[model samples]
Every structure is written in C-alpha cells, then in structure tokens.
Target: MTELGYAQAPAVAAREGVPRPCLGCGAPMAVTADAQLHADATLTCGFCGRSETMPAQAAAQDRYLRLRLMQVRRAREGMEAPLKTYEMMRASGVFALIVFGAQGGWMLWGAFTTADKGSAVFGMLGAAGMMGVILANFGMMRAFRKLIKPLQQARPPAAPGLAARCRSCGGDLPPVRSTHATCAFCGANNFLDNAAAHDVNALLTAEQQDYKVRASGGKPGDNTIYQRPAHAFYVWGAAGAAVTFVVGVVLVLVLV
Candidate 1:
C-alpha cells in the first residue's frame, strides 16, 4: 500500500529504463494523473483498443507499484466507509433506545400520577417530548437500511488464491498485491505476478481505479459513478435531530 507512492507522479510507467510494454501491442503504456488527479491507465492497445487489467504485482516494477497501491487504498477506504457508519449507528441506536425507553416510561408515569390538571397536562406533554426523542432515534436506525444493504453488497467478494511465492527463494509471499513484500523465510522482495496468477488481482485493480476516481476530491473524473457526499452521516443526523425537536414542540403546543 505504501510503496505505490514512493515511486513517481505517474510512478508505474517504467522498469529498468525500458517502458513497460503493453501486453497487447508491445507499445509503451504511459500512466498519468490528469487534471482531476486520477490515475490514467489502460493495459490495452492504442490502435486496436484491446485492453486487459493486469495485477499491479505482476505488471510493473517499483515505479508502477506505487500507483496501484494508491488506487487500491482509496477504493478500499471508500467501499468500507458505509459499513463502518452502519455499525456505529446500529450500536449507538440500540444503547440510546434502551435508555430512552426507561426515561420515557418514568416521565409518562409522572404525568399520570400528577393531581393538578395544568401540571398533569404539562407533564404529559413532557412525556410526549421524551417519546419524540425515542421515535426519531428509532426511525433513523431504520433509515440506515438504505445505505446498509448497498454497502454490504458493494463489499468485494473474497476470492482466495494461492499465496505468491518468493521469486528468489520460493518462500510463500503473504502480501500478494505489493511489489515490495519481503518474504519472512528468505527476506526476498517477492509477490504474485499477473502471468502466474488468477485474474482476481486484475479485477481488484480495476475496481480500485473506479473507487479512486470517486474518492478523489474536486469535480469527479469520467470514471466516477457518484461522488461520495462529504458529511453524509452528519447531514442525516442533523435531520433526525430536527425531527425530534419539531415533534416535541408540536406536542407541547397542542397540549397547552
């Protein structure tokens, strides 16, 4: 993940001073970050448009490895963000609901037991306000289904492949996607290459590119499907809070 940035601006372009040949046409594949700071790449022929995604590990050397890492990291974070938020919401909502139920019940009992008519009415209104808090919190938790299911689906299904073997000593390589994974057994920088492996790495690399485009700041590039709105959780939270407030106020007004 870290090594991808240590290479260059368009780091994954060269290896041993020979341009990384396009697998399709043997022409040099030039990698770039355009005006949108997106990693521009295609493992395809310029003339024939024959493209294929190769594993970053098998494809290029030190230079291009960095670019691949950048895309992978960005995509991973983007895809995982919704899942994290959903977990937080689910945990917090349950805790709050437990407390809310106890408090609301106590308030309603106070309203019921009060002798004075005016005081009893105000107490009932206060109980309603408490109920508002519970209901709003509950609704927000339910609303999270819109994001939760999508996030769950978006998670890349894991495809277990053979661990990349160290090129120098045949030791098992744990970090399959990296260009600089040092083998514990032999201390050799070895990883899985595209040729000797399944297309899983290439599929991940392509997905990461799309995620990186969406994760990128500023106007989205051509590849971006939908820009992730900043502070989405906060916006939804504020909306829920506003609902609680409005419901409480309306209940009090109607009672008085």
Candidate 2:
C-alpha cells in the first residue's frame, strides 16, 4: 500500500477484490480489508503504475454530491410564495410613501384655508388620511424586510467558475468565454454549451438550500429586523403627526 494525494495505505488485500480503476485518478485501483472489515482502496496508475490511495478523496466526493442535492432543494423553495411576498411588500412600500407625501401636502394646505366649518372638517379628514398612509408605509417596509431576510441570511452562491462543470464529460473545465469548447480528451466541441449554466445552477442550489433551512426552523434571527433600513415614511409620519397635533392646538388657542 502506498500513500496518495490524501488517502492512507491499506493494511491487507480486500475480500471484495480489487477495483479496476481509481475513482479519482482513473488508474487501476486495489482494495484492502482492515481488521475492522472495512475496505480501504488504493490505486496504481495504469501508465505510470504508481501506487496511490484515495479513500479520503472518495469521502470528499460523497460530501460534495450531498451538498449539491441540498442546493437543488433550496432553489426550488426560493421560487415559491416567499419570493412573491417580498416583491409585493417592496412595491407597496414605495406606493404608500408616494401617496402619503402627495396627500400630506394637500392636507397642510386645507388646514390654512376654510371659509366654513365643512372646510375645517375636510382638513381634519385629510390629516387622518395622511397618517394612515404613513402607517401603511411602515407596515409594508416591515413585511418586505421579513420576506428578504432569509435570502440575506443564507450564504451566497458559489462563484461562477467554481460551480460550473463540463456537461459532456462531467469534468471541471476552466472558465471560458465561449460556450462551446472542444474537450481536451474527448474532442467534444459542445462540452458545455451554456457558459452561464453553472451560475444558474449555483443560484438555484443556494435558493433551495436556503428554503430548506428556513423551513426547518432556521431563521435569520430577530437581529435581522433591526438591520433593515428604516422606512422614510416612518420619519415623515412622526413629523406629520407632530405637526398636525401642534396646528390643532394652535387653532384651538387662537379661537379661544
């Protein structure tokens, strides 16, 4: 037995017989059985015939496959209602802010001009409407933050170059500008027809993993709520509420 990249030498010949090729190097592989009855594997290069072991490499490959499967699941979850809710909340926040600002201006003007009691009533109604809009904006912003919080908490997707694999040969290829490439070994020109496929795959994987984690009771924590940017309307609402209260007070004082 001989040490390879990351595998240790096996102790005895395996009962299961030798594997024809090394899983990692594609060299002729041998199997050995240990006292514990576990089979440890090693490889001898076909051309060089260099003795090498790769049990650790095999274990790592298994882990990678599991991780990729998890990622696919997460991506599917991301395409669901949670994403839509986030978009809706974001749009509503913007709409509420705009409506509040426009109506606030009108209300302020009505407060100053009123020939009759009805005009004064209209002014009070406008003030209430503006307050409602401001509150609505705050609610929308809060909802938006909740929706995107999971995405923000989840790990980012793998870099494009790292995620991509050759479609035809299943080999890791260098980042190339051209989608079509001749495989160095197989002579397949369409080894990976879509260069962006890796990126898309990674994104989907991340989303799927995130969704599973979130569904399993993993959350971004309460701290994420405070991390969200304060909605502008919240500030405006506080200011408008204060101003309205003051103006009403002044009017009462002047009338008395």
Candidate 3:
C-alpha cells in the first residue's frame, strides 16, 4: 500500500538481468519487491546475515513523474549534436536548389537565344557546367543521407544516475549517503540507505537506454526513427524540380 491509503499490487516487473550485488556481502541481492522494496523496507543479506535499509523511492522510481520528465530531457540533450547536424544539412540542400537552379536556368536560356557564335558557345559551356552542378548536387544529397544514417541509429552512452528527489513533496535531495532524508516541503522522513540507492541507480541506468533510443529519432522498440530533416531534403527537392519544369515550359513558349 502506498502513502495514499490504497492497496498496491505486488510488482511483477522484469528483473534487472543481472542481480544487484549485496552491499554487505558482495552476493546477489533479492530481485522481488517484497525482498528489496525501499521506504522503511528492510533487505536481509542471505549470504552474510547483514540487514540494509532500502532507498526512499526505490520501489516507486517509475511512478515519479518528475524523474521521468528529467530522463526525457536528458535523452534529448544527448542527441543534440546529431539533430543539429541533420538540420544544417537540410538547410544547405535548400540553399543549393535556389542558387544553382537559377544559375542553370539562365545559362540554358542564353545558350538557345544568343545571336553571336562565340557568346553562344560560352553559353553552351555554362549550360554544361549547370548540368554538372545538378548531378553533383544529387550526389551530395545521397552522401548526406548516408551521413545521418549512423547518427539516427546512434545510442546514448551510459551516464551516472540522476539526482534523487524527495518522495513526499518531490523536492530535490542533496547527495544521499545516509539512511534517511527529511523532505524540506512536507517534513516527511524518507529512507535512503546505500543498498536502496544502488537499486534505484540501476533502474535509472536501464531506463536511460530506452529513453535515448526513442529520443534519437526512433520509436519505442524501433531501431531507427524517421529522420524529419533528411525527409525534408527529398520533399524540397521535388518541389524545386517541379518549379524548374514550369520555368522551362515558360521559356520555351517565350523563345518560340
């Protein structure tokens, strides 16, 4: 039962694959909540007869909304570099389409309409140069698509446990080294022994892996997320192509 005066179900969540080592005896600690639940709970070391108090929120780490929110923020911050790189690549593609597309259209127009043979030959050279630019731009886009593939699939590296929060009022707790903490807001005493802290830290570590996977552009359980910046390149590229075709039609009509 929680402090809210309701009967809570016994936790059947999957155990951390490796058993947490007992702080006292360096043996495997109990995996179930009844054996390891903190908040005035006791865990006796089966190997050494040593008793340890659990952390204040060890059993209820998932229920803390503040802690979960912090995890999300941390995951997004972890992917900041890749996300920024993708956006920069997308912007450069758009800039190239505008500048190169205009230059190419002008060169092709001059090649067709020039009266002097020398000027016409120069315009033809410019038109060839424009075709090369278009091909190079296509190749660059492909390279960028490959560049962000690794980034989108990248996972966050392991990090330290997040700062602990007060169980009663959700206030931040100073580095917890002892067996108890007094919440500044609610004045409720909380348990936070070394064994409990270890368990809680372990939970945070596992949750961070999932959080990072989702934040880096992939859905939960998915290996890759749909990268919007990369997708934008194709979308704008199509639009630019359509505009160039329309301009070509207009030029043909005017020149004929």
Estimate the lDDT of model 1: 0.46
Task: Give the Cα error of residue 255 in candidate 3, in Å.
Answer: 20
The better candidate by lDDT, 2 or 3, is 3
Which ranges in model 2 have alpha carbons more than 4 Å from their true place? 1-86, 92-104, 115-117, 151-256
Count backbone overlaps in model 3. Answer: 3
lDDT of each: 0.46, 0.45, 0.46
| lDDT, candidate 1, 123-228, per-residue tens | 4444454454455555545554443322322212234654554433333456445434654332333334442444666745755675676688644433221122
Determine which window of 10 residues in candidate 2 has minimal summed lDDT: 1-10
lDDT, residue 203, model 3: 47
Q: Which stretches of candidate 1 lie over 4 Å from their true place?
A: 1-70, 78-83, 116-144, 147-256
Q: What's the TM-score of every candidate structure?
A: 0.34, 0.31, 0.28
Best by TM-score: 1
Q: Which 10-residue span in candidate 1 carries the lowest summed lDDT?
A: 222-231
